[model samples]
Target: MLTKRIVPCLDVNDGRVVKGIQFVELRDAGDPVELAKVYDEQGADELVFLDISASHEGRKTMVEVVQHVAAELAIPFTVGGGINSVEDMKAILRAGADKVSLNTAAVLRPELVREGADYFGSQCIVVAIDAKYDEETNGWKVYTHGGRKLKDLDAVEWAKEVEALGAGEILLTSMDSDGEKKGFNLALTKAVSEAVTIPVIASGGAGNAVHFKDVFTEGKADAALAASIFHYKETSVEEVKSYLRKEEVHVR
Candidate 1:
C-alpha cells in the first residue's frame, strides 16, 4: 500500500507566510523559509507553498522566495499562484520546486495544463481547484481569483477534465470548510477523487488527526493538507501521522 502523505501548507503573501479563513482576514504565520525548515524537520512528507496573492496581484510566483524555501527542504515541494505559462513553470521548477500548481491560469486556458505537463512531464504538473458548494446547482462550484470569483465550472467535472489534460495531481480545496477547523469536506474530496484517476490532495478544514484519518478513509484523499493547525502549532505533523497509524491508515 502507498503510505499516505502529511503536507504542511504555507500560504505566502509579500514574502511572509499567512493564513486566513475562507480566503479573508489574513494573519501572519511566519517567514516562508523559516516555516518550511520547521515543517521539514517535523517529518512532513511534503510541503506546499502557495503565493496566495500572486494571482490577484497580477504577478508570477516569487522565484526568490521559492528558491530560498526549496533549498531548505529534503522533501517534495509544490508551488502555486500566478503561474500562467509554461515558462513560469520552468522557472519555478529550475528554482527547485518539484511540482508547479496551476489554478486561475489553468481554468482560463486549460491547454496550459497540457502544455505544462508536456514540457515538464505530468509528474510536475498539479492543478488546484478551489471550490464551494452551490446549493441551487446541487454540485460544487469552482472558484478563482483567490476564491473570490465563482466560475461556471463544476468542481467534479473540472477535476476530470484536468486529469485528461495530463495533470499529475489535483489539489482540491473546499472553500466552505477552509479555516473552519471542523474537518475536511469529505463529500467534495471523495467526489473529485472518484472522478479522476490521479492522486487527490485534500485541502481545507483539517483541525486534528481524526480529520486527516476521515479524509483518507472516507474522503479517499491520497494526502491531506493543513494550514492554521500546523502553522500555529495546534497540531504537529507527527501527531497526525501517529493518530492515523493507530487508526490503521497507512502513513509515512
Candidate 2:
C-alpha cells in the first residue's frame, strides 16, 4: 500500500513565509529557507512552497527563494504560484522542484494542463484549485490569484477536466476552511477525490491529527497539507504519521 503523505506548506510573500485566513489578512511566519529545512528534518513526506502573491503581483515565482529552500531539503518539493507557461514550469523544475503546481494560469488557460503533461509528464504537473461555496450559485466557485479573484469556473467540473487533461494530481484547497484551524473540508475533498483517478491532496483547515486522518480515510485524499498548524508547532508531521499508523491508515 502507498503511504499517505503529510506535507508542510510554506506560503511565501515578499521573501517571507506567511499565513492568512481564507487567503487574506496575511501574517508573517518566518523565513522560507529555514522553515523548509526544519520540515524536511521533521520527517515531512513532502514540502510545498507557494508564492502566494506572485500572480497577483504580476511576477514570476521567486527563483532565488525556491533555490534557497530546495537546497535545504532532501525530500520531494513542489512549487506553485505564477506558473503561467512551460518556461516557468521548467525554471522551477530546474531550480529543484520535483513538481510544479498550477492555479490561476491553469484556470485561465486549460490547455496549459495538457501542454504541461505532454512536456514534463503528468506526474510532474499538479493543478492547485482554491474553491469556496457561492451562495448565489449554490455550488463551489473557483478562486484564483490566492483567492483574490472569483472566477465563474465550477470547482467540481474543473477537477474532472484537469484530470482528463492528464494532470497527475490535484491540490484542492478549501477557501472556506483555510487558516481556520477547524478541519479539512472533507465533503469537497471527497467529491474531488472520488471524481478523479489521480491522487488528490487535501489542503486547508487541518487543526490536529484527527483532521489528517479524516482527510486520508474519510476524504480519501492521498495527502494532507497544513501551514499554520505545522508552522506554529501545533502539530508535528511525525506525530500525525504515528497516529495514522495506530488508526491503520498506511503512512510514512
lDDT tens string, model 1, 35-107?
Answer: 7777777789998888766454323436778788777777899998888899889888999999999999999
Residue 238 of model 1, lDDT score: 84
Candidate 2 residue lDDT tens string, 91-116: 88888789999998999899999999
lDDT of 2: 0.85
Give residue 72's lDDT in candidate 1 (0 to 100): 71
Q: Candidate 1 regions off by >4 Å?
A: 19-29, 53-61
Q: What is the Cα-based TM-score of model 2?
A: 0.89
All models: lDDT? 0.88, 0.85
Backbone Cα, N, C clashes tallied per candidate: 0, 0
Looking at model 2, residue 124 earns an lDDT score of 95
Off by over 4 Å in 2: 19-29, 53-61, 135-138
Name the weakest run of 10 consecutive residues (lDDT summed) in model 2. 20-29
